[model samples]
Target: MLHDIGGQAPNPRQTKIAVVGGGSTYTPELIDGFARLRDTLPIGELVLVDPAAERLELVGGLARRIFAKQGHPATVTTTSDLDAGVAGADAVLLQLRVGGQAARQQDETWPLECGCIGQETTGAGGLAKALRTVPVVLDIAERVRRASPDAWIIDFTNPVGIVTRALLQAGHRAIGLCNVAIGFQRKFAALLGVAPGDVHLDHVGLNHLTWERGVRLGGPEGENVLPKLLAEHGDTIAGDLHLPRPLLDRLGTVPSYYLRYFYAHDAVVEEMWTKPSRAAEVAAMEKQLLEMYGDPALDEKPALLAKRGGAFYSEAAVDLAAALLGSGGSPYQVVNTYNNGTLPFLADDAVIEVQAAIGARGATPLPVPQLDPLCAGLVANVTAYEQLALEAALHGGRDRVFKALLAHPLIGQYAYAESLTDQLIAHNQEHLAWA
Candidate 1:
């Protein structure tokens, strides 16, 4: 069904892909992937769509040069108009930040004042991002539907679980993606002395809240080398997560680094208060990246971009897009999609991140072994918060914001929820129309 676009199958070599936030410092990283993995996705045209004219031109120019340098024949173009850019495209990638890093700096800093972890995709800060992002993303999806009805929207936006749910609820064709799974897969492979493709993760839970229950070699049914990985590389893996080695040994599972927020809330809050907000560091990094993009001779992604994070982003994007468009990609990948009984405990419409078969019909989550009560309870708690968050994002009101914040496990107390609600409104009033 995914291949049947307007009753005609899409030509694999004529794929057109659009990056909504084309001007972002992250664009080059994505472009680098398109160039390096051209055989995987086979993009005929790449469009960079953004409202920021200056940054769009700079990123667009670098993108073309990168393709040229790689000897890939894809035509790279830039445009400020959204509809024009996505028209007839086979896939559209959403990476826009509604309020940019200045707003992200506010999202990361304000919540710490309430004794909660300040993060762009979790806690009160995440709620702020979801509220601003969901509406804009829905509007863009609507336009994409009108312009290219069969175009698949590959959302790499933060608060992915929430945004993808919004698109699906509105009846749009979409899939949510993140680099965390691929990043872990690569790290585990290196530790086991194997290829990244040879590694398969029994990765489950909501986006940003997943745990790797099993790390299989060769395929999903292949030997689960997770326990071996923990035994051999416990200290190294635990160090990366910033969690205690004993915790991993006891649980016998690998939690994503984001879990540190929930697993060690107060300690993380204390550390966040001491360090510069991640958003601030990224904003400074973006300034430098933009200046580097102005360089005409730089045809490849800079080593400095590695420090910008989103590790393995391009590979993940290309894989998801290729699979969804009926091109040859990995048979299985970790993606965010409808729960649809994947976790029977949650509503069928709830969006969840898990390992699934990726193909033209979109993601089909592999059967999960029974989840531990410890992780299941946390996943359920966050799912409830996400549902409330979506309600508030779709229909804004101060009360709705307060309800979502209060529902979050990190801010269950009414007093803290009230404070965060007021702070979030004050900081993001410009973007929230109801405010």
Candidate 2:
């Protein structure tokens, strides 16, 4: 049985929601959703929690203005106190970055030194992020558990699979969320010239590493039009993924762009060598965004925030929160939840991202057709790396870190793993208690 937090159901008209990293530039996007979709999840109170008091104040001010402009009745408040912010929240969203973009810059750059893709959420860099992030998230989750025992924890942190597994292993009432699925739903909907809600994706695999095997119209049982999408708009999709159209044609499924780091590792490494790390770009963007937020006249999410990434984040968060709170939302949405035999090859306790029926009880993955060996092989490999990553995150030791890095498909060479492990520890020593 799923663990029950045991409380009276939340009053839909008076729901209290807390965002742990609420001072984020991403908060405006989320606030935009709460204001626009108020009827779906009527929040009586919304709390923005962050240790950065200055950013909290700026973001909180904007949040209130946005809500007022939208004529939403919800009260918006800001706090640096985690416990106080989450005290009575019906749902708490996690989007904190443990070491900020500086650490991320390190995560991105150091892996490239060893000729590997240096992304914040994949390869050796991802293991580094997992190490820095998992412990912090678990600590925050524990605080929420104590302050709001019935509060549902929605994790949007990077390296989501590893962090989420740590949460479940510790018995926190948590579910992982990402924007990839919803992004696809919107993209495909536009291509099909239908309402976004009318499109349902047969999205399956682990977080970040997923593929859309089928695109159903009207509903899950609706006719699959994936082939139609490929035939007509294959070039657009391939260009977006930075991969060739023939590859998608050969696979007959749409792989997440993250796959490029794996499918074209050396190519991506070469590309990274020429471009600034994504962290640098985001850091610069954030500076500009915070300045924009301080403008009293700016009451909406900036167009620049769109380029800051996390596309469709607000909608996905609102939908997942509503469904988990027993409020109204789409019956089928994609989320990261316990495998529970969803994929036969993975451990039941493993976390996988797939289209699921989300309700107050939590996410139940829909039955997935057998995965083609091409995708399954990679998924299984990454799942193993994720398992090892969680173990290292939960405990702290150089050996564990090295093993996780070695297990990752993107950095399988023992020499690279060993070098990356040392660099990871050197860069993240302050965050890792045992480093």
Candidate 3:
């Protein structure tokens, strides 16, 4: 946390933000947010940094055009150098994919061979991603820290908990970012017929493993409308969660979509085998998105970008950055920061995603209700797995990977961990340096 020389008032100074994975198809969405949110986070410059030269050119050019069309005054630049791109920037946003869609394809496939749920950021697959991603992210973070020591590192990477913990352990000023909580905020707001700003959610637990127990109106002290939401929208919400309405009604809480992988492990594994990997789908969409960006007249975010996923991501990033940089807006936003006793059961250093008051000093987790035994137990289980996953990610080995997988509730069986560990290393040999 940096010292606040000025009071809690919003800082009007212009800022420089560098997007580490600027070549991603998602960059335009972020650029669109910056254009619309100029009043919130005034940008002096926005740099796009990526190793892929071709994609960087397309994404950066379209980014400049989008800003120009929106009458935004910020400068947009493209670069392959992480150090130069981050040098003197106020903040850096990380949205990197190490093996591109190919690695993600492997991550989503191999675990299924051993009868485990195959997903990018959980189970055996997420472990593989953590192995491939953590070192790369750490290397890049070192450059960011050197280039701009005071810059805030906002990570939007997959397997966010493991990657973020790695960053924080290394003593970087980092806070993980995800769009899941914001998705719920937007949904509840739309249902309540109130502006999203008026809604505050009790988003507890870790990334991907979270629950919305209470949805309050106005501020944190406002009336909790969670019961009304469940009673009136149970069926719709159940459909979204893929859980039986009885289960949601029984627990009196709405779990995140990723919970489906756990709550219905065998069912999801059987279904995942038949469907193409999400990476394959996103790759196809990225092709079309790049084509659309090449259009000289195209400036606004294309409809196909929605198909690429990450709906309302730019808005969340804008709000979070504005809050973190002390630009303005409400005092609280849901973010991935250290627990610091937010969950009494979890370690103080454990990273949890919950409502946090953001400012120049950093985020402090807001007060949350006592966790139900069910949610607390699951949260504790996953947090242990994440810690082991980070260990395996940092110091690579087949045994370490196996231990991490065994720690996961979904792959607790010794047989599954052994076979999945072998398959993970085999599938991701290129991405895993030790392999």
Please give each candidate's TM-score: 0.97, 0.97, 0.96
lDDT of 1 by residue, 22-75 (tens): 999999999999999988889877888999989988888888778878888777
Q: Which ten residues in a row have the lowest lDDT in candidate 2?
A: 1-10
Error of 1 at 263 (Å): 0.7
How many clashing pairs per prediction, in order? 0, 0, 0
Output the lDDT of residue 340, model 1.
Answer: 95
Give Cα distance to truth, residue 390, candidate 2, Å: 0.6
lDDT of 3 at 279: 83
Candidate 1 residue runs with Cα over 4 Å from true position: 1-13
Give the Cα RMSD of candidate 3. Answer: 4.8
Candidate achieving the largest lDDT: 1
Residue range 151-238, candidate 3, lDDT tens digits: 9999999888889999999999998999998899999999889999999998899999999989999988999999999999899989
Total colliding residue pairs, candidate 2: 0
Across 93-174, the per-residue lDDT of candidate 2 in tens digits comes to 9998989989999989988889988989999888889998998999999999999999899999988888888998899999
